[model samples]
Target: MQDRDDAITPGWVADLAEIGELVSGAYGHYVERMEMLPGPMRTDYAVPLAAGQIEVLRADGRIAGLLVLVPEPEHMLLDNVAVAPWAQGRGFGRRLMDHAEARARAAGYDRITLYTHVTMVENIEIYLRRGYVETHRAEVNGLHRVYMAKRLG
Candidate 1:
């Protein structure tokens, strides 16, 4: 796993498409439940990639997962985390999440924040297992979002 904090470069550009595909594949199943494309599916990876807020997790030298983490003044925002559909059962999501917390710790942050669609129960459950507490819920951009936070010791 590597976290890229430099301005967008050729390598980052090349990873954009793959990141999009990974996010789409991971969240596409919720289209029926949500009656529209999920937020992650509609995201343009370039914005975060250019801002150096994206990180990629590779398995066997191929992109298996990606994380979008933004450092806030008080907390690290784990904006997104997606595991390739094919890699779902292999613990890549957990690894990426572990990486997120590690990054936050390395950056001197004591907390990490994230949100997921309300309908994404599996994701909420996973976050709960990782010691994240529900902060609140709100409708943002037409999506019901469940916000969560983890205090990093």
Candidate 2:
């Protein structure tokens, strides 16, 4: 991990669980698969946050988004990104994504990779617009996933 502790605000750590709630509807299609996933791992970014493996974005003095990045030998894995529904379409998602790209670049990583559920077509389109190309598709943990990546300049 990149030790993102200093990059995220302190108070926001406690609100990640709350932030996780923002994506509940987006994950509605995965009710069954979600159950297949271990309890805490289901939309919980606690592990990554505590490990300094991700960053959180706040808006109006509150937690509005989260970016989960896992350090890999070849690239930074964009494990997850979620923006509060109320904060959606307000540029928060792009801001966090841009930050993730910069973070990856600064870490000497040439790429950033991520995956979204196939059912979440909107997310797939958003990532595509951000320049992430689909690398392949896979079914993991009972969920159909589309893997994507962006090469950093």
Candidate 3:
């Protein structure tokens, strides 16, 4: 996995457009499916980019996806993850999640937490299959979300 902190460069500012495109392309279709913009679709990645929390995945020398991981006192938060629409079905999303869990473990974290919109049942199922358990459900920021966590062994 690329060290997000070490990977930042002056070029990152220029790459924002490509990063935004990947994120939007990944989540844009959900806007209609969910009847509102999905959280990722509305996000401005500059915040996370500036915080050194955004990790990029590349394929064929092109940005194929991104992952945002935030370390909390108690757990590492897998804040956001997305693969470009054209890049889906290539296992990039799974690889990114694995990187998040590995990073959490390397960072001395025993647990990792994440949430998805309640309307994204597929994501919830994928998390479940990967050993994440539903911790709770709540409405946050005008979105009904389902939170989940996994214990690192």
Candidate 4:
């Protein structure tokens, strides 16, 4: 496992684009089967470093993952999260989640919420193991999206 103490730096939007391509290619079958829209795989929606928001992670001098937080009235939304193809199966994703939770708590936020396609069972299990609980569900892009929440307080 990569050490969490290792330095994690900000990743640029350009890097995120590249990461998105890699992720899309790796998960293209699911994306196509689910009939996702043809456009940018990763959408940049939040301002960088705003209100406990961040969008990048570079671990040990390498692009490790992407994390975007959108501040909300009651909690922060974990809008986007992706681990690099080379870094998958490691603890990097968990480290990113831990970092996000710590930041949200320090920002006085009481909860963290996110939604992911139900077909992404591995992701659901990961979040569940990390203390997230399913809060709702809906069908989007021909796939079931399960919304989850984790209290940070």
Candidate 5:
């Protein structure tokens, strides 16, 4: 487990990029397993926001993972989340979700939302375990995508 109170710094960009690549590869695998197009992950979307992104670092100062929040009027959307391949089974994703929920509660937001491909059953299960429920499902880019929401009180 990682300490949540540590300050996030800008130097974690390279680690974040590596994590993004891992995520993209994982997503591509999921898509292929479901017979969908293996579209490229939008790494560019992550670049400009590097300074404002949140990261979790190990005790030795290695970046463990990152979660990007896109603030909105009604709620905070989990725009992106990635954990390094080496750190995948260590509950880092859950930790990031916990941190995001806390931030949403502190900001007085009523809900948190995110979207993931329907074929990504593992990811969907993780969200469900964390109290998110599917709010909608739609076909996008030839794949079924699910939108989920969790109330933050």
Candidate 6:
């Protein structure tokens, strides 16, 4: 990771886009089955990072993962966690969750929340193992959403 806390740069966005594409499979099946908006593949990630809320996770001295977060009135929203497809299964996701929890605590939030498609069963298990409890499940705009939250100290 870079040693700076500034907003994401254009170069950073490009790097994230590449990783987003490579890691799009995490949501590919759900997106296809539900015809979800944006279709699981992304080229534009600037909207989420526009407020300088995105962070990068590095691997092999290169940009390989992203953690997109947004601070709300009561908690921090873990908007996205993407690890390069090439870099998955190497414990990067767990590390990213740890990073998110640490950052949320530093921001004075006791709770952090995130959501994933219902069909992303593996993701749900991972979150549960990370101490996130299932808050609810809903279908919106033809997409099934499974929401989860973790309370931090």
Pitting candidate 1 against candidate 4, the one with the higher lDDT is 1
* Stretches of model 2 off by over 4 angstroms after superposition: 1-13, 25-41
**Candidate 6 residue lDDT tens string, 14-68:** 5655556645755565566555653235435666656677777666655556787
Q: How many pairs of residues collide in model 5?
A: 0
* Candidate topping lDDT: 1
Writing each residue's lDDT as its tens digit, candidate 3 over 50-100 gives 888888877756677788888899999999988888878988888888888
lDDT of 1 by residue, 48-146 (tens): 889999888776556778889999999999999888888778877888888899999999999999999999999999999999999999998899999
* Residue-by-residue lDDT tens digits, candidate 2, 1-153: 222322444324666656566556335445675454422237556667678876676666556677778899989998877676777788888888898898899999999999977766788899999899999998876777899999998
lDDT value for model 2: 0.72
lDDT of 5 at 83: 69
Model 5 per-residue lDDT tens digits across residues 14-133: 555655565574456665577755333644645635646554444235556667776789998886666666667777777778888887788789899988877778889989988999
Model 2 residue 60 CA deviation in Å: 1.8
* Structure candidate 6, residue pairs in collision: none
- Clashes in model 3: which pairs? none
Per-model TM values vs. the true structure: 0.91, 0.80, 0.90, 0.76, 0.76, 0.80
Off by over 4 Å in 6: 1-11, 14-16, 23-26, 29-43
TM-score of 4: 0.76
